[model samples]
Target: MSNLPPLNNETIWDIINDKIDDAMVNQLVWDCLGYSYDNSSQQWDINNVASEWREEYPEPPNFIENRPPTVKLTRSIPPENKQLLKEELGFKGYKVGEFGPRQTRRATVANWLLSYMKQKRETSDR
Candidate 1:
């Protein structure tokens, strides 16, 4: 059983605010709210959703027009690499057939590796 709290309008707004900058916050807030509404009610109501969002968050930040991505990269881990990663990380109880949970653990391990590498480089440079 997941311990995550149920996501509501305010929680969605707070999540957006935390993950995104002010310029993108309003757009994401509306996007998440609109999606949640449509997902629950099976209907679209962008205008009403926007209105409600505006009422909740008065003086919303200015919308930023889409800009070209600064950089792009593609990455994929092969099965052999995943096996190596599992062995290297000493991951436990992760079944081979499950992708989602394994992928999450792989990402966590990758991040830890990167942080360790960075610290090692910094120490060696000193």
Candidate 2:
């Protein structure tokens, strides 16, 4: 039996969105992470380049499924933590797509769990 929970309903989504990272639901709380609803109505300022960049890049859909990353990581994950997610946590990569995107550091982490979940469910059915 795989450690990963099979994707059904919203289990996988929760894991990707809430389980792994602390997400800020509030928009008014001042912070340099995620979106701030309070700033949504700010007038466009030519001097403040940050205002422009805020709209351009957030958590890009660098992963598979063309799905936006539910976890908005602010920093690079340490190697030890990576090992935990990979070795103990049982994260796997995509079965489809280019090799670099599929196997390299940019490989989809959620896809790892999702693919394994699918495999586990398939074998269990038989």
Instruction: Give a tens-digit lDDT track for model 2, residues 94-114.
Output: 345635422332233543444
Worst 10 residues of 2 by lDDT: 24-33
For each candidate, what is the lDDT?
A: 0.35, 0.35
* Residue pair clashes in candidate 2: 92-112
Query: Each candidate: RMSD to true structure?
Result: 16.0, 13.9
Query: In lDDT terms, how accurate is model 2?
Result: 0.35
Candidate 1 lDDT by residue in tens digits, 2-117: 22323333333333224434333333433433422345765444554446444543433223221111010002223334443246434353356755532443233333333333
State each candidate's clash count: 0, 1
